[model samples]
Target: MLLALPPLYLKYFEDGYLLVPGFWTIFFFISALTLIVFVVVLTVQQKNNEMYAQAFLGATTFKLLACLIFVLIFIKKGRPEKLFFVADFMYLYFLNTVFEIYGLLRTLRNQNSK
Candidate 1:
């Protein structure tokens, strides 16, 4: 998915500039963040599967807060590409979130079946 984003961005958003340095960096960052969240949730599920919802919520909150901070700092740095940055960021966030939820549900289902 991350690998495919660049073409989509180039095709759809000609002016889109994800994160400061480039799209690849931001993509990797978001991908890494998603992995961290997924791992943390998996750990929590192993310890107490019933806490999946809470764990997901907490991870989401943390991600949102981190994104907010990033946005604030980016804005402060005088990056005038708000629309491009925001659109790409939100797209990445949404995609990663859905992927996370799907993986969690699959894990839950597997555990329940056992």
Candidate 2:
């Protein structure tokens, strides 16, 4: 829903195809990271419960660095509505981060109950 809404707005009300493609790219990038994090955390949790936290932290650092690199690359590409791009990027980043944290919390809760 988050990924699709922007494009609809752009198509009906905007002039460019900027936000749609960029949002899709970022959405997939973040989705991949989320999957990797879940897999790594689940593996470590199963293999050595003591390492689960560390695994989560490592994955988070990786995601943060990846996002930074992505932003840097976008900035280096050109000066096409730089502020809007950054703002949209940050908004999506925050939305995804919150979603991830919510998922993590739910996972942790389930684990604790078990």
Candidate 3:
């Protein structure tokens, strides 16, 4: 929820700068999906290091490709405010990437300590 505050505030109170229609719904859905993927990947990681590595790499690649497709579709059918979409997309993408990395590092640190 913390990740959503700025966007939510902007959308409702700040003249909706850097946002598109249905932005919150898309943001929340993506965030939830990413969280689910991370949890599943981490659970698998705990069972087998080899599979963990492969799963992690595979998940990352899949996410990148999916995001690319989403961007393409958005460009084709999205609103006229292209620049706002870019800003919103980057905000979600980079922050989610950071969270994913942090989760991976935390899990690794726990594994190492054990």
State the TM-score for model 1.
0.78
Candidate 2 per-residue lDDT over residues 1-114, each given as its tens digit:
565577667767997556634666766776777677777777887798778789888988998998899778766775547666766677777777777777777877898899
Task: Tell me the TM-score of model 3.
Answer: 0.87
- TM-score versus the correct structure, for each prediction: 0.78, 0.78, 0.87
- The order by descending lDDT is 3, 1, 2
**Where does the lowest 10-residue lDDT sum fall in candidate 3?**
71-80
Model 3 residue pairs with clashes: none
Which is better, 1 or 2, measured by lDDT? 1
Model 3, 12-105: lDDT tens digits are 7998857877677568756876787698788888778769878888888887888788777767775647777777888888888788888898
lDDT of 3: 0.79
Better of 2 and 3 by TM-score: 3
- Per-residue C-alpha lDDT of model 1 across residues 1-114, encoded as one tens digit per residue: 754566466757785334434555567777788899999999998899789889989998988788778667766776647677777777777888889888988988999999
Worst 10 residues of 2 by lDDT: 16-25
